[model samples]
Target: MLDARAHPSCISVAVSRAVGEAYAARNAAAQINCSETCFVLAFVPGDLDGRRVAAALEEALEGVPVFGCSSAGQITPHGYETDALLLLAFPKAHFRCSSILFEPLKPLSTTAIATAAQRHEKTFSHTAGWHRLGLIFADGLSKQEDVLISTLETVLDDLPLFGGSAGDALRFEDTYVLHQGRCYGNAATLLLLETDLPFRGFGFDHFLPGGTPIVITGADPDERKVFEINGAPAAQEYARLVGCAVADLSPQIFAENPLLIEYKDRHYVRAISDAGEDDALSFLAAIDDGLIMTLGQGQEIIRTLQSGLDIHDEQGRRPDFILGFDCVLRKLEIEQKQLGRAVSEVLCSAHVVGFNTYGEQHCGVHMNQTLVGVAFFGPDQRTLY
Candidate 1:
């Protein structure tokens, strides 16, 4: 049970297990006080009908703009959940937003996207005392995230952006983003938000680069598919590097032993999503030939996760709530290590409300096996609506 009174500074959060029906959305919507709500963000279970959920929310919310996508799983006030429909209502008293939807993400035109984003930013009325940030939700199966995020960052310039690729419960099929009352596939949405509360955007993963470097000998960057690694079949090479047989390759194995690529001064994981035909490998993020990467070594996941979420303001006050975009791979890793309950405890204490994703977007990069989020802190001595 989520008690809104427990966190006065936070926005309304409602969760419902009665899915695939209108009454369930109505029951959930009834829990949120929508008088001041500007928009409602929803995280629907991948097993449900997106169109049905979208229609229900639209009818129940009575015209409050709704936006979101199907997720691999949700993190509610109660922590990790798989079958619930989660909603977060952002009140107009504290937040304002404008959203843009891009369909047919394939054959994406960076030029067009950049132009539209720049124009959208300029046209949106900037609130006098509010800080600005961006959130994006794209079809997880869409291989366009790398290009999409990079273009947005380049055009938006200083505005911080964080998001996740929508997932279908690890089914790796048919994912959709919902806007208004419609569900769209091969699509994405960007929400430019202005908020009065102080906030911080961050991302982290629990892995370190260690071991001999493996070079990408052949790859299809556009498709994010690797054909060869170190002159051997991609999956075969990865299995050898991780000390596993080709037949033993699995999501858990990929999560446990990810490939790390060096960028600037830090390393980022380039997770393999699946082993494909002819020992080929499909990745979650962008990949190309001649890219040198190393096997990632595990760390104390719980410790790193706690440290990552334990953010404090100048006054040493914890955030009221965190909007998290955790990768599904991370969840897989935690479950594999039998740390689900422990990890859920950490998230519940941190007041995390969001969903697990196929990939995460932070700053200007698309990454895998990481958690990206924004933490919001209320103004001192002021009550949030």
Candidate 2:
């Protein structure tokens, strides 16, 4: 068990590897001061029972609102952790939050979502001088992020949003997001937060467009599956382009060589999740017929990651902490290159906390194979609320 208390900072983090939900919750709760917290965020291991963990946390915190979801893995104080339950406590002194839950994301009603979000934004009283931002946790397997994020962005204009799709490790099966002490699948939650601290939102990847542009000839946009690329079977063409047999294709290879799409003169990674039936390729982000993409060439992972997290303000002050949403595909590539320890050291040095995600959301777009986060810096001049 690792417990970290950030004195003079408003956020407290606790991590526990205890066997059962009760023990884990108790162990984590003992490290935080519930009285000082407005709410708690819990990242439960995908392998653990989220319902039991919810119950245990409810009992442990005694009514402090808890919201979060299952994760592929966790970023604790000690770095990447797989089997631990992690909790982040946001103190009432520095932060205030209001959350909205959207269920049945499959039959996603865009108009309804927009109206509800607009209403929530209008009704939630905002502080005069505090910084406001949005955080979303959605069911990763629902395949609904592309539309959901776009809708929220339209309605909640000017409010910066950064979020992650809830993951169930590598199972690629069921995933859940917790709200009001219950775990809900096929659902999403949005937390609108106001904080007095200075902060910045960022997203970065180590890839650049390298190969000839390939067109997606046939695809199922709703399912995020590509049946054909460059007029050939998706998987077969991908393998040929990468100089490997179809059978030699795997997650590691896909991570090493990803697809990049150019939008607004900027390139973004479109990661592959799996090679499926009938030579189809499954993507982590949205896909469509006639969309153009190119193979991405990677740079030094450690250097790029370090440069990405080496953020500082004009005053030369680093962030007190960062809430990060890192793609699991990136994690796979890092492990394949034997850079886990080095990456973890960088994460620890930067004070990053959060989880590995199936997909990441930033700048009004759903992306993959990228790290998106918000870094919170301590207030230079303290002011009374």
Candidate 3:
């Protein structure tokens, strides 16, 4: 999809994965004269090389900044896809972006992160009608997202933040975040956005508590590993509650039935991503020993998505495009229920561009099984326009 507006900074999206046709991806980005292009790549074991792909894109786009990372699945105008590449080009006229990279992420002190955030904040001129947002891309395997987001939030104060965890498909092995032409592991990159457009940041999950509370009796808070729930083995107990055996529990099962934790009066999903040999359950978000979690049921996804997007549409002005970070677990649920077509229709109609993530970050908290995004309205909607 391409925006044909007369504005200087229009956007366009392209996707491809033809065998032996590697250059097609980079060429796609060059065709659209964007100042910066973000690329989401498919996770194929040894077949994909980050350095080579980055070089090709750099050579093709010349001086344009290239960013993004590997994804569990690519989200495009056509629908959800695997083994494909997707790119989004941001025009230079309306959008200005600056980024910071935090490496060896786990040991970075909150003070260091906060300092970096404060420095980024100082670069922007806070005009009355201008909107600014922070876009983050982190390693899904780092396990440092919780603290990093918290510290950054403290420094950002009121500047809205939204983003996703980079994934290597479902491999759960290694994930990389792209900056310029290099890939960084155990790291995170933040993009500071400045635009003169009406925009809103929002997040949603199509699930509600089922009223059955499961108490975490024992857990490894540091690793998000639950050893016991209600005095029984975590995996065994969860399977029993879901009407399935421990061995039968899979991503599909976990997607249909998830756990939700209420924080500050808002509910967030604590999705189970894997089961250990000792019958322990590992969650996507941080899990503690004393927290009480409720089993959640999936709602009508299409309606929920539409209603959530509608909340951002004000004064009859709809979003021109949305930069979304959707959870992969949600994709599994939609596919398992044969709702791919319907879900794709909604995503396309809403002009969503992004990828399925390992997790989502919003308002300083790392969450699971949710869709977080920033919707940008057309320039004409702004007061200055």
Candidate 4:
């Protein structure tokens, strides 16, 4: 277990399962002494016991607005972890957070989301010289993130949105978002934060395109599936290029190698979810016919990740805290390459507070295998490591 208090307004803790849930929640909240706390918790398959965690945290937080979600893996100040609970506390002195729970997200309308954003902004726009950003946690299984994020963008209007889809430890059965103390599946929780700090929102992946280029010829945009690449079966062609048989296509292969799509002269990763029995490929983000894709080659991950983090340092300010939504596939790539410690060191040095997500939301688009986050820089604070 690790506890870190970065500033008078922010603190973080990683609690192990060995500690009783109630004791851990109460003690961690008290130690941080913040009004807005986000907790990332471990999910036990078929347990569906969010009530236990919610009740305990609520008892400790004492009506302070608490929000979070289940995670595939939690990131703390120390490193990556499983079967642990991580909490990030943001005190009212430097930060103000307001959340709205959209229950039954399937039926979520754009107007309702916009109204929520407007309402939240009106309530808290009294503060000045503070940066604003949105943090979102949605049910990963609901498949409604694309619409919800875009709708909220209309209201946020360049305020910048960054976050992730909540995961249930790879179970893929059900995932939930937490608001206050209740767990809601098929729901989304949106938090609008006003921080008295110089903030920058960023998204990046550590992969570069290679010479291999493929084009989507047949697809189901709604389902995010591509059946043909360059008029050939997606699985077969992808496997051929990656030096594997179609039958051997797996998530691990997709993680080690990704497909890239060019947007405005830069390439963004389009990760594969899995290969289908029909030789189709499902992507984490939406894909449509006529989109050209190029195979990507990964860089030295540790160096690439550090370079990404170093961007803030190059800008004459380093982040005091970074609320990151890291893709689970990236985490898989780190484990496959045995670079966990190095990557964790970078995240720890950057003071990242977040969890591994099934998919990440950046700006207004839902993308795969990307680390999207908001870096908070205070005039009085600097990098710790």
Candidate 5:
């Protein structure tokens, strides 16, 4: 049963018990041809010990390679999950993996990120320009993703980067990074592959913004913090637009009505994660001065998420694995209608097995709401069409 596919050799899924690790393991096993078992996890919240967790994982994998991090939330074929641990094991022969950690993002510089990315790429690029994709996981709170993305792009142009931030179950404190049976803080990791493979990172949302544009009048690029927009604090202007009290604003509500910013003509929505002091808004992505941003449009209870599956069938491509970067707000929207179970069913039907991210990265840019995801089709399995 040696699947002669030059796709992802294997995928390692690691989540917390709060995320229902047992269920996650079942789904992951069914996704790709995983080896024996998964690198299991039990997110013990405040008492987390990376050393203990890593040690257990290394022993369990029995020398098979494993890589992942603690998540703010996890996803399965069943959609968004919380409070559990999940880890999937895929072998190295099929997937050449390299793990790296990059921190000290405060005085962020593209030069530094470029250097880091080059070094990280070299880890698995043992054979240059042969990698199929780059899986990146960085500090969610780093607040300098723009520099990181730019640096990676410069080094790995068109080398598609897909992944999400290491989240801490909405606690927003003490996020962790996992590598070689050890969890570190304020770090980043890259699991690389040196396979020439065909892949596409696709996305579709109910995105149809109101088309009203507002300018970012004041801000600090270095901090990635937006203070004022159109003559008032960014948060205040947003509150007025959404007709909600500034005090009532939060990441949950802001995600419901994300603001869309125009970049290079096309539009991209920026998910506001935190509302800081004096009406400042902490955006998940970059927002430049004089940029025109419109209110993003999408229903809380979107119904067409499964429409993509048809493409999978019609295009003659069967997925080897699905890496989903779902916004936490989208999960809330699903929960509001008690559609959690239904959403989960659709994702399960899609054979998805990954984690819920505070935010997602696609082609290196950070975004929310939209499912900026990539599906791998083994060179052999994808011939179904």
Candidate 6:
């Protein structure tokens, strides 16, 4: 195992007020000192040209393989930000990296996601099975994550995948994908790293069912639409229970009281991504009958943060970094509670530096209310290697 003390991987982040030539130079200097062979770079610029920003980032890195997307919000040792940059560096021998790119993706399709993962595995095989875990990200615009996640599970086997979508600052308008210095839209990116690195991984999220759980009586996942809950139109029924007009159901409201789905003792919250006409509610995940659901809220971010920190301490590893995957909903919840200081406390305690995401993935499975992370214990200090 990699040592957690000596020769530990170093991580440094430089978020600029700008992403022009000025910010790129400073960010490059920080990365140059930290990364051995390569680093995972993310740019969350507030106002910048897509092509120009990508080009500047590429030039600043001096040809290092660059991959990451725009973030809705970012987390660092300092705090969260809407306009800034966050970069993480891993030593060359400390990690073997492999990446897969898929483009022009549409709504969820398990078969399509499976195929993408298979192709990614072929590329990952060259890592010589040293992949300790995966960091997965995608176009925030892609809504088929549930299908994509389940498909990757079949191919990745036991490897845990973690990361989030490239957030567009909640603009929800135009989001870009970055790979090999090129930017695109409607794409998926996966990073597989092989190493005997010592690290701990886990995440947390909470859903309080406000109403009685109802089974999914009908769904049209491909269309991103749900027609029924317990044999009744999902939107109409849910609205009646909440005493709100079905037409008034908004993404903001959907996030507060998402439809909860129960499966095998675990309950998953499916937030409304969109509300279709005529009492149809589109969800972030697939909805089928027989699954009990209740309206949920982000009331437990404080608890989730505490539990996440507890789990991190139990990992038996000294963390160099904690890569996080938090949903945008969590971001909103933070603002609601005015818990920025408290949230930063968790990162400071764990020594975390990561970005907020659209939707998070783990073990090749999509998830929410979870802070999927890998806490590094430098190989130079451990006997695992």
For candidate 5, the per-residue lDDT at 252 reads: 65
Regions more than 4 Å wrong, model 6: 1-9, 19-31, 43-46, 107-131, 230-233, 243-252, 276-278, 288-291, 297-299, 312-318, 380-385
What digit string (tens of lDDT, one per residue) describes model 3 on residues 136-183?
Answer: 888888888888888888889877888899887677886878787677
Per-residue lDDT of 204 in model 2: 96
List model 1 lDDT by residue over 354-374, tens digit each. Answer: 999999998799999999999
Q: After superposition, how far is residue 77 of candidate 5 from its true place, in Å?
A: 3.9
Candidates 1 and 3 compared: the better one by lDDT is: 1
Error of 1 at 164 (Å): 0.6
lDDT by residue (1-385, candidate 6, tens digit) is: 2122212245445555555744654554454553455555665554555566667667776676767777777775565666666655555666677777777667446566667677766765554434367677777667767666667766777777677776676667777777777777888777777775566666667666565656777777566577887788878887877678877876556656666655556666666666677777766555554556776644567776776666323436556666676677776767766877777666666666677776777655565545666666555444221
Please estimate how well model 2 matches the true structure, expressed as its whole-model Cα lDDT. 0.89
Show pairs that collide, candidate 1. Answer: none
Off by over 4 Å in 1: 3-8, 380-385
Candidate 4 stretches with Cα past 4 Å from truth are 1-9, 19-30, 34-48, 311-317, 379-385
- Write one digit per residue (lDDT tens) for candidate 2, span 1-385: 3434322265999888899888998899888899999989899997689999999899899888899999999998877878989999999998999999999899899998998899999998989899889999999999999899989988888899999999977899878998878889999999999998888999999998997899999999999999999999999999999999999899999999999999888898999988986999999889999999999999999999999999887778788888999998889999999999888888988889999999999988999999999988888633211
- Supply the TM-score for candidate 3: 0.91
What would the TM-scores of all predictions be? 0.97, 0.96, 0.91, 0.87, 0.81, 0.83
The prediction achieving the highest lDDT against the true structure is 2
Counting clashing residue pairs in each candidate, in order, gives 0, 0, 0, 0, 23, 24
The window of 10 residues in a row where model 1 has the poorest summed lDDT is: 1-10
- Alpha-carbon runs more than 4 Å astray in model 5: 1-51, 119-131, 195-198, 313-315, 381-385
Candidate 4 weakest lDDT stretch, 10 residues: 39-48
Alpha-carbon RMSD of each model: 2.3, 2.4, 3.3, 3.6, 5.3, 4.6
Q: What is candidate 3's CA lDDT for residue 86?
A: 72
In order, the Cα lDDT scores of the candidates are 0.89, 0.89, 0.77, 0.74, 0.62, 0.65
Per-residue alpha-carbon lDDT of candidate 5 for residues 105-130, written as tens digits (9 for 90 to 100): 55666677777777666554355433
* Reference-based TM-score, model 1: 0.97
